[model samples]
Target: RPVCHTKPQPGNRESVGCLYSCAQCSLGGVLIAMDTAPWALDEKPEHEEVCEFRPYTCPCPGATCKWHGSLEAVMPHLMHAHKSITTLQGEDIVFLATDINLPGAVDWVMMQSCFSHHFMLVLEKQEKYEGHQQFFAVVLLIGTRKQAENFAYRLELNGNRRRLTWEATPRSIHDGVAAAILNSDCLVFDTSIAHLFADNGNLGINVTISMC
Candidate 1:
């Protein structure tokens, strides 16, 4: 028999069922956890709206760019402190990233502002084996993680017969361009396609961004 220094209170019936018995103290003599009501196991609260898992709506102002993110990251993301691409926000605006005639591997980063928010876009020239060349293009969001999911980017390569196009949910610039390219979210093509789209030394594309 073990000597007991403490015991469960009468009101705490939940602790009375403990297995150990103490000979010296009646209160501590028998103590064990009582079984919880079966219904307690079935009580599940809805968590879709819980803060940790909930999507954060971005506080960025303006119309064209719709952004969302986690509440914890809302401020830093809107501050636009990171550096990787130039940010631009506007409507029906066209800007050049690089000169098409420039040879070798060249990467160009630009930010476009349209409908009031900034988006990151990139143009990379890849020199292939045997002197062949390829160009890659992509659009990215500068807002939050949740914002990245709601928006879309469309790149149009205008040609005489047909137009080449690539569209995807833009990645957050926070992910870095290398990561986005590795995921193959950007448009890629060779010099032949470039030749068709290239006008003079400048290659131009019509970018259409939207939220869905």
Candidate 2:
């Protein structure tokens, strides 16, 4: 006996053809036949603001120059307009000595002393993080021990006023003594008075005196 078989046909318009034959057809070839569709922008998609385009401001005092909104623009202006200052790293201490060439400006001397003390305080704060062994102390000596003592007293007063506390270290005292001796403007001066003490096992401070 012979058997008869009939090919399956789509009963409805929505019916898809057999999967086995359709699987053999290339999807890329079909896509090429249907041309690339145009993108519609009738209701344009919104984009988030880029953080890079935000305005940048500089902290340099009395600077009016404004260009591209970024720190890159302000840095060059700062370097060119203002003098370059050194930043000490890794437990560095700096002492500054000022000489009184102009007489009777006691207020100015007091102000300078206050400034020097503040600088030392900042160094001491950094020392806490870097380790006490890596700390640097600077003392600025003006004319005589009396003068230096006066400044020291002022520093103590300021500390009391601000309620600031600092750890007392031998290195700090040594730097203070050295600065007092080296900071002089007079042509006739004694170099023997200034003293420097290094608390660390190693001595590595480079001291330079500028007499003008």
Candidate 3:
């Protein structure tokens, strides 16, 4: 129901026939598009891609979560339903996931708050094949993709005299982390390497976020 509405021309006295120079979003953000049709603003890829008012789904580490709502409701939902998720402050922190060798699908979720924003860090382990286990670590911003573009994140695993690291921009909650996981765009490792980085069945990852 977040439709776009047209704006009147500077000197226009009548509503109809006025140049549809801009479209106002329901969230009170004005999108200026002189040559674009006001009716087409709803489907405009540029607008739709970064519009903060768009509906967003839960970015929790699992696919079973079906909650979806406006961007503003994300934090409240995360706080209430994901009460077990750990929250850490600062741009650099260590996310320690206990029992990395746990069998079957497992997810370790944590929230990182810095620079007046919330970031979700997810570490998941799953058996992608019959006998091979894969680990994925990714960071997601609890904001619009436009806002997410302003930040970048880094994930590092250090142990056994070796280090593995991945650095990239944080994906927006709207964008989700599924595609990144499917494409292996995040920090990925196999069970063997996971054990190499695990200390007493726990894995500690150095996570850092910064403005870009």
Candidate 4:
């Protein structure tokens, strides 16, 4: 008698490809392909089917529901909403420009002397940096040589001993004081003076002097 083979049902749908058996004259059977399409002659049953869609959720705080096409889309949301922002560029240093108008024509001698006295006190105190140091240096340089010399002597004497000292002479104190202020890390000069000088042609000499 010839035996007939039964077709597999949905419950046994583990194999999606076509199946074939030997001639009815023999009981021997073999799987042509383990996992292949039905169109190939050596094809076997497919164990798993391809999924059409996969569900996902938004990475937002409220567990917002949304389908993201890729992980790239999620990155921006995390960065703008969750990640901290930073800048690659460094901070800029601003310089103040001042205009000094005089009633009468002023000679370089007078300007230099005035600036030396004004900047000498500032250079004595080594607390501030940046705007303070820059402005003081500019003013001192513009003043007379005698004033610069006097300021210099004062700075050397003051810094010489553990006790602070002042000199009555006129000398350029620019180099010594500048060196001290620049070397000290904690020292920071007032920046407001720049705004004051820029707004008004008159130098904020009193403000700068008081800071020293």
Q: Evaluate model 2: give its lDDT.
A: 0.25
Q: What C-alpha lDDT do the candidate models reach, one value each? A: 0.60, 0.25, 0.81, 0.28
* Candidate 2 TM-score versus the reference: 0.20
Q: Rank the candidates by TM-score, best first.
A: 3, 1, 2, 4
lDDT of 4 at 116: 21
TM-score of each: 0.56, 0.20, 0.75, 0.19
Model 4 agreement with the true structure over 79-190: per-residue lDDT tens digits: 4554432211111111222343332212111121233232222322212432333223222221333434433222111111322222233322222233433554212323
Candidate 2 wrongly placed segments (more than 4 Å): 1-52, 63-68, 84-86, 90-212
Answer with 1 or 3, whichever has the higher TM-score.
3
How high a TM-score does candidate 4 get?
0.19
- Candidate 1 minimal-lDDT segment of 10 residues: 41-50
Please state the error at residue 169 of candidate 1 in Å: 0.7
For residues 19-61, what per-residue lDDT tens digits would candidate 3 score against the true structure? Answer: 2222324533433433444454445534445455557889996
Top lDDT: which candidate number?
3
Could you say which candidate leads in TM-score?
Answer: 3
Task: Kindly report which residue stretches of model 1 are placed more than 4 angstroms away from their true locations once superposed.
Answer: 1-91, 127-132
> Which has the better lDDT: candidate 2, or candidate 4?
4
